[model samples]
Target: MSVGLVIRLIVLALLVAFLVSPQTFVFVFRPLVRAGQPVIYNQGSLIDLTLNHLAIVGTAMVLATALAVGLAILVTRPFGAEFLALSRSLANIGQTFPPVAVLALAVPVLGFGTAPTLVALFLYGLLPIFENTLTGLTNLPPTVTEAARGMGMTGRQRLMRVELPLALPVILAGIRLSTVIALATATIGSTVAARTLGEVIIAGLLSRNTAFVAQGGIIVGILAVLIYDGLSAIERMLMRRTGQAGRQA
Candidate 1:
């Protein structure tokens, strides 16, 4: 009945379909291909590819979040305010360059594997997080900061006990956006010899097998949706807790 319940159900369904009965996808994808063509992507296990894809996205997000949030915190401080413009420009550069181009340039040095894909995803996932974190930190109500100061809170104490808790929801929203972007973008990594669902899509493209492409695209789509929903549920929970705390205080 509730939105949270609906999201949990959707996430459960997706996980069951992908993990418990992957063969179910064969029937779904079969209609997209000719009768004689194989309906499943047989070159690599879909589960393995999915895991690898998650690994890539997860690792990149960790790096991106750390740097983006760290930079955002710095820029919001008086001493670091001057670096704000430069940080924005740096974060923008990542989104400006296409993942393919980043791969093209990185492959020469990283040489065709998960490393370059990680680099591309890391760069591609930075801007949204940085921008959102900056907005969250900078836009806090002046009254809240004054209250914290009045309570004899130091800058670090205010940030740790007051600001960060308040900013978490907005910061998480940014992470959610960046993560969804990375899920789709990570598929491009397969072009550089990285293990991803893009391998299935690319194979299908090469062989003209629509089913393979559909299977890969559908799985990625479902994953993105499920992950987005999961993150949203967490965000809503955090917001509710934050509100409850505010009311009690």
Candidate 2:
């Protein structure tokens, strides 16, 4: 349909083709591999690795979004106002502690595989979404909220019909940021024996096979770009709708 949509589809097609038959691109990467090394990245199925990577990242994002948004909504309420600073500090913990550090600490408790990675990513993604949600909810025009209350709306009704609608654009921006970051960071899951594209990159690094690194990096980069663009489009659409509503009022 649209040019951007067509471009995204082409990228998705290329990614699928590459994952299904990575060796087909051997010529593109042959020069990058060591003299005696095979040009293809054959450690595992790229498709499976990509799917697993997406699943881990998606799970983390869902968890992060739920927690962050809920906490943001909580702190903005009168009953929870006093806990704003505490909530911020808690969200900041993930950013303060590196993913590697989180992973290392979690491995002992979670015992490897996807569990540790999920924890790390969930923590890492919390700050942006939480901060953005807080900003969106807190920054609404007082007049609009007052109007909703004047119309005999309950707190829940005002929040659902008035506050959240206006805040959706800003909240979506946070989600966009979180999702993009998670897509790239999920690669680190491979260190804990989680199947991910990071395995290819790590393998390349260990064996000095540039092809592996390049392919892994390319796929991750493409995925991030695609997701970022898609989320951005959604954010823009929401903003447009919000603007239209404002003008109508």
Candidate 3:
């Protein structure tokens, strides 16, 4: 079969698995509810879960980008590159720690609620965005930068005009990855008593309700797909704009 056809078949199979049984049965878990009220996964509950999740993830994205990009820029300088090894070590360590363990540890300092969740997401998101930002800037033609400076462009002007536009796609890829992962991890926040779709999954497990688990898990999957795809679309648009700008200049 053609590659596109194979992909289409795979997607169809996945859709069927999700909609039907066996997959939802969760061999490791049993059904939670029976008849009447099975922790109903309605529009309202999902909205409540999703909205709070979006807030936490969005906040993390902003914070991660700011810190990652800023630090990447700072560390790219000769003085800063001296500390690159240390910077990379710290980022690697941050990602290596288990998120639940981190959350449990942070609870004492950050207290409960969305704050801890946001902190967790922000830290988790840092490495990808930071690494990609550093990579893109470093990969830029050194001669291009020298030429811009030779043309009397200020540091700010060179960065805004040359570095940022060129580096945007790689940075966006990192951000998109961060966003989807944050969406998945945000579900764990519900376990910590944060308001999130994970509440449904947790409650289902607590009460032995498969329906609740399926509903929550399914919604989260859907949300992740939409958000990732949306970010990718934005990245494509940005890339196109970059190309057009380069052509124009």
Candidate 4:
């Protein structure tokens, strides 16, 4: 139990405690509100909202990872090299348009709730994953790749066995970045009637209840920090496995 690990555990415990029995923590938030305003977000369960928020982020991440990583793989290969710029442009298009605008445009076609929110998140999250994967694959040590080639490995074999393994830490780093962005950005999904933690935030904003706002912000912040820390640990493990950690250190 390193100090960092201990701190993370404490944060995790606080989050669970808040979600499991929110009223118990009302005293903590009571100071932020007026006499009659509610301290807790009462319309929906915090656990349900958090789960819905995670579901939306997870789905969008899956879609974005598949397309972004696929395109990254394609453009890195000899046959697909010429299309590198095009792939970059395509990924950039997602980030170029704001999620709000994406949702607004998608609402007419995909309608409201989760569908449009998913579209917004998927597009908004693509660029980081794509760029990171591309950077990881392209910047691998020439000698390591040459050794793989010397071992009579096929292009696909080298990619699957050598390249991808070495590149995974970086790829994971990208996914981590994208996921964190999606987590926070998903809050806006409530504007389109999506079931997310954003609903609590929006309600607080609408009713001018600072306590509700603090509650929503705190939960989302805890989630983002935990997920980021978790992903960073995974990334570091992958780097060590691939010997990148030693080289970097």
Candidate 5:
């Protein structure tokens, strides 16, 4: 494993320990709490809150990836090429609206809790993934694709075995970007009764507790950094494999 990965794991372990026994952080948080307030955030278990936050983000990302990648693939095909403009416009529409606005509009229709958050994040994440997938698919080398066809590879075979493999690194780059953005943005879900680390930050803000804000911010920041680094490593590995395949061929 990479040094960064190891370090991230260590940080994650420490974060978990802190969350499990937040009182262990008394020395740090005690000073930040108001004169009469307790050192720990007792509203909910941090572990539970973090898990719920990840669930919301993960669900949104999965939905976004499926829609974005599927649409990109469709638009890249000869039969679907005419839809390119429409696809781009649709993805742009998702991004053009702010997440908060999306949430506000969705809440009345979807009701409170995770639904609105999921909708907001799904829309927020679509543009990057779609754009990157489009770039990856459209930018493949013509010679390589022609060779696949010359070798009697069917279109589906060429797409699955040749094009997508080469384009994976680029696609993964989009996923990494989308995931990071969703991680930060998911915190906003707390406003609509979603259980998230954002609840801690919001509570802190409401009660004037700097400790709560710091703890929430630190956990979210750590999660984003770790996930980003992990995806980058995966992308690099994919790129290296593609390079090796090209050399051997």
Candidate 6:
């Protein structure tokens, strides 16, 4: 096997082993702490947090996609384009607010729970998705769009069949960006007593337990890597299919 492929396999094996281990954390499982480790807790709190991260990130992704697509479509028109600068400015503001602060403010109104966290995440996720969708749509070759219009295609038909397919890759890239940000930020949710992997880190930090923090942080890292990679694989597959179909006679 190629050296790069072999290394990749080894890393994947280690990640899967650590993920499935009873200790559920590398620090807790270590005896002397240098590659060889013993199991501690036969439970997986980190896995639970990983699951929660997925939920938060998924929710953010849905909101981001809807908002970005809406804004992209709206701004494409002459009259609506008047508000393009304003729309982008508002999106910029959403991201400018510190997510933790946003969560803190949301707590009283939404209560101290996942609802506030999701709200923060949704705002955090919006700008990238919205901007990319707009860029992708506007960058479409004029000739191709003109041909679609010449074929008696309605606006919706051109958007759904011709324009959106061309823009799909960039749209998915926005989703990938939002996913990673949400995973990392979701750790903060533990501060508000949310039932996420953040719980492990906060508990450990409060108690000065390195094992808890390391375990929680590492699991979240792995979860982000895994999800990002999984989505990338799906994106590549879809892109290949679309490209091949677009090229066929």
TM-score of each: 0.92, 0.94, 0.80, 0.98, 0.95, 0.83
Worst 10 residues of 3 by lDDT: 21-30
**Rank list by TM-score:** 4, 5, 2, 1, 6, 3
- Summed backbone clashes in each candidate are 0, 0, 4, 0, 0, 1
Give per-residue CA lDDT, model 2, range 1-249, as digits (tens). Answer: 998889899989988998988878788998897678978888788898889999999999999999999999999989999999999999999899999999999999999899999999999999999999999999898889999999999988988999989998888889889888988888898899888889989999999998889989999999999989988888778878778345544
Task: Report RMSD (Å) for each prediction in the order shown.
Answer: 2.7, 2.2, 6.4, 0.7, 2.3, 4.4
Which one wins on lDDT?
Answer: 4
Q: Candidate 3 on 116-233: residue-level lDDT in tens?
A: 7888888899899989999888888777889999999987798889998888888888999988998899888977778987887887788777777877787678668766766786
Worst 10 residues of 2 by lDDT: 240-249
Q: Which residue runs of candidate 1 sit more than 4 Å off their true CA positions?
A: 1-11, 244-249
Angstrom error at residue 221, model 4: 0.7
Backbone clashes in model 5, listed as residue pairs: none
Q: Tell me the deviation in Å of residue 69 in model 3.
A: 0.9
* Candidate 5 residue spans exceeding 4 A from truth: 1-3, 244-249
Q: Of 3 and 4, which scores higher on TM-score? A: 4
| Model 4 lDDT per residue over 85-116, tens place | 99999899878999999999999998889999
Worst 10 residues of 6 by lDDT: 32-41
- Residue 86 of model 2: what lDDT? 97
Model 4 clashing residue pairs (backbone): none
Question: What lDDT does each candidate get?
Answer: 0.89, 0.90, 0.77, 0.94, 0.91, 0.75
Greater TM-score among 1 and 3 belongs to 1
Q: Over the stretch 157-208, how does candidate 6's per-residue lDDT look in tens digits?
A: 9988998888777778778888888898988987886767787677666665
Residues 1-249, model 5: lDDT tens digits: 978668888998989899889888789778788798767788999999999999999999999999999999999999999999998888887689988999899999999999999999999999999999999999998899999999999999999999999999899999999999999999999999989899999989999989989999999999999899889989888988888345534
* TM-score, model 2 to reference: 0.94
